[model samples]
Target: MMQQHGQHGQRDGVDAAELAAELAAELPADPVVPRVEAASVAVNLLWCVPGDVGGSEEYLVRQLLGLGEQASDFVPTLYVVKSFIETHPALAKLYPIEVANLTGVDRRRRVVAEHTWLRRRTQHAELVHHGGGTTPAVGTRPIVLTIHDLQYLTHPGYHSKLKLQYLRRTMPRSVHRASVIATPTDWVRRTVIEEFDVAPDRVVVVPHGVEADIGVEAPSEFELRSVYGLGSGRVIVFPAITHPHKGHEFLLDVMAQHWDDPDLRLVLLGGKGLADQRVAAKIAELHLERRVIRPGRVPSSHRDGLLQLAHAMVFPSEYEGFGAPVVEAMSLDTPVIAADQPAVSEVIGDAGLVLPRDPEAWADALDIVADQRVELIAAGRRRVTEFTAAKSGAALAEAYRLALS
Candidate 1:
């Protein structure tokens, strides 16, 4: 009996050792799973905007920074131009950064650098994400291109001939080369796929995100009136670059009608663009010099304050990839009077007044917005929750995964 017990104990010990050895062998075979958990996939982000300060540049900076803050599965190496680094000095402390000494204004040099220098530098990257409109013409790595809009093709009058030609030639090729195309709105997604003949599955719509709590102390009324010459009146802010497509002329026309009213002021925020000469001419034609205040490119910190101080925000653009101002104004609980376009309508969604492109209609809507301020503010605050960084970041991460797959 004692001998039988000993034999049983020996059998149990052998069986336990065999089970442990089998488990150890399985672990080595699946070493990738453990390493994947330890490290993230490295992606190259091409953020080469040098001179631009428009919504596209803002979107790229905010979204990339947001992704860098949130993404654990993928590590992004931001490749920026020297000017970008100069503009945003704090970026160095946040993420892995590389700078290319390229000028934003020199198209020829930019193209050469992209094809030769930028292309060669990104060889080891798992993928290249082009936040600026164009991608490297020659590259083996898969690309994810963000095309804000096809304004050059849609409204040729809005762009210079050279710019129009450059975009016409390069945009379609970029679309073809991209593994995935990311747009800010569904309207843009459909337009790009249809115009470029790209597969629908290759497109992803990631809307812009607004700050959850944008609380900026506004400059006192005295400061605004004394410094910027924003007169004592019911203020309507139009925050957009003075591009022809932005329909500043229409807003100026409306301002012309309101010129006689001493209590109405129109604050035009943003720097001048190619069509700014035309806009300046129209402002002169209307003799709205005093009634319209052109405080070109207010610092971003003051934007929310400006919006909060406004009685209403007007977006008169005829074309847009996304109406960022509309969302921004809404986030600040400011009433919006926007053009009745697809992108604007989609973003506003009955939260604010959407009127026809007619100046008379917009003028009338602005009047209504002033009266219904309380209701509009509440609606706008609620509407802005739909657009948040968490939502956009998740969609962007999924787009990267799709591109990699």
Candidate 2:
């Protein structure tokens, strides 16, 4: 009787094991989850002041927007100020923006926030892209620093004593801390490497690119003329603020040379700058009030319409990390006559007339604009295509990747 009972128990145990095996076969295997490899990049624009940084501000904004639309390797988050959001509401919507509780116009407060608040907020980020050309005293992640130009070092007189002191104190240290330095042109890249004593490999030339649809939504020439109170003269637009380095005085002098042509006009098309009083004095000295127009920062459409209607665009700035306006003029199909600075020459690349900063040289270049108008327009159109936002975005993303690697 005992042997029979043991045999029945063994059969029952075998049946239970078979039932468990059947249940296991009916159930789904554990799903394999793909690992996410994209890194998080915190773009620090804590130093950006709307309508203040000028071309540098435009460059950074375009690059960020380009990256959002074109690159997918990493996620980018913008750390900006309230003014940035207010000025760039459309851009603000595209990113995960973290606004600092302070204003960007104050340098001391910005520096404090950068060292303390910014560090804590960016603790989880794999990389920090410092767009302001300097890194925080205490960085929490590897930095991809964009040094627009070593202008503070090269042209010390252009900056205030306090700013020079701040730049001198921070630039070298930031260079040392940055894993990679991005420059808009090879000229700037070489300058940064030589000035900072960093490895050449550490500095990358990420060329600045223009928006493809530049001047697309421009107002009509008639409307723009009436709004700016401009007359029926052949306009020569120099789309830069009234700054000393921008050669506004020189351009004014050039216009004075062409005063014989009473029908010619020169439009100084940007906001006021440090050299405002000096420029006004120069204009008055040259007696070009009738011939020159200072619109003091017009809207994009107005600026574009002026560009479209202009006989030519003259960029006579003494220094530029990248001659963005040269390309901007090109994109708008306007003939460019630029100063023969290294970056400007590099950007012009036989696409437009390059000349010395002398007033006589510029005056002569202006004379030939009508003759070379078609050729210049064609060359410019071709050259502008090479500097698209996609290329810029891809180059910047690669720079970020290099910093990570």
Candidate 3:
């Protein structure tokens, strides 16, 4: 019985020994390790402006919308003020938004609120894009600022004393603080580098894109007459706010010279600006009430209709970051007679007539454009293809990638 028990114990020991050997062979040589993954980076866009703010504001909004449609390596979050969000409810659904309930009562308060918000809420962001032409003076996040133009500095007379002072005090610091700056044209890019004393490589020139579906459809003469109180005349559309630098007075002068032409009419389409009363006074002094029409801020469809039916688009702005109307007109195959500013010249290329701001030169160019309408229209239509949203979006995406790297 003792011998039998010893044999059974020995068999049990052999089985245990085999099980231990199998476990040792199946086990890894080193301790088990965990797989680590990189956290995704996020980009924050700052666009805070009232709904009524004009072209530059509109440009920024469109840019944000286009960016949202694009596929980026990093996630994007738009930080909009409460008022803007309230006005644009669709914005909340369109992008990931972090609303800043700011009271933009005055410039000082607005600036303070923006700075505070940036400091507190932007820690998680790898980069911040300031779409409103200004950046927080104090922030650690890498910033990409879009300075539309140095017009406040260049044409100080066009801006209020308070606004001019504010820009002078803030613009330089903002430019310096930015990791990269974006401008709408090469002219603006060069100007920013020279004026702000920024490095050339730090600035990128991103031209504004033309809407893909912007085309001309003629409005019925009767409908135009009924709605805007206009007769069947050769319509010249001037799409600009009544700013002093917009050269409205110069256009008015040209119109005055041709006021006696019964078949001619001038249509002005935009919101009133600071110099609106001045323009009204000039219109009264020139006795152009009968010849001029002010359809303030028409809808996009109506504006397109005006452009479609107009004989020409007269844009005589003395300064521009980018000539949006010029491109819009070009895209619609409408002949453009623009001022010979650097940005305007670059945008017009060989498509439209770029003339001096002098009324006589503009008049002659207008006549020339009327004579060469077909050729000019063809040229403009071809040139507009260079400024599509796809092209601009791709450029901006690359710029963002560069900023991140």
C-alpha RMSD by candidate, in order: 18.1, 19.7, 21.3
User: What tens-digit string does per-residue lDDT give for candidate 2 at 310-366?
Assistant: 999999888888878888889999999888988889889989999998777776786
Clash counts for the predictions, in order: 0, 0, 0
lDDT of 3 by residue, 1-405 (tens): 000011111222222224344443432243332221221222333334553445665565556555555786644566765676775565467566666554333333344445555445565567777766766566655778877788776777765454555567667877888888888899999989889788898899767886577654546556776688778778889998887788889888888874457668889999777678989999899988888899888877788878877789999889888878998888877899988999989988999899887777765765787899999999998898888765665666666776777
Top candidate (lDDT) = 2
Q: State the lDDT of candidate 1 residue by residue for 1-405, as single tens digits.
A: 000011111222222224344333322221111122222333333334533547776566666555655744776667766777777665566656666565444444444455555555566677778766666567656788877777766677755454555566667777888999999889989988899888999999978876555546566557766777776777889998777778899888877764357777888988776578999899888788878888888766566677877889999889988888898899887899988888879889989998888867765676688689899999998888877755666677878888989
Once model 1 is optimally superposed onto the true structure by TM-score, how far is the C-alpha of residue 345 displaced, in angstroms? 1.5
Best by TM-score: 2
Residue 199 lDDT, candidate 3, scale 0-100: 88
TM-score, every prediction: 0.85, 0.88, 0.84
lDDT of 3: 0.69
Q: Give candidate 1 regions above 4 Å deviation.
A: 1-53, 217-222, 258-260
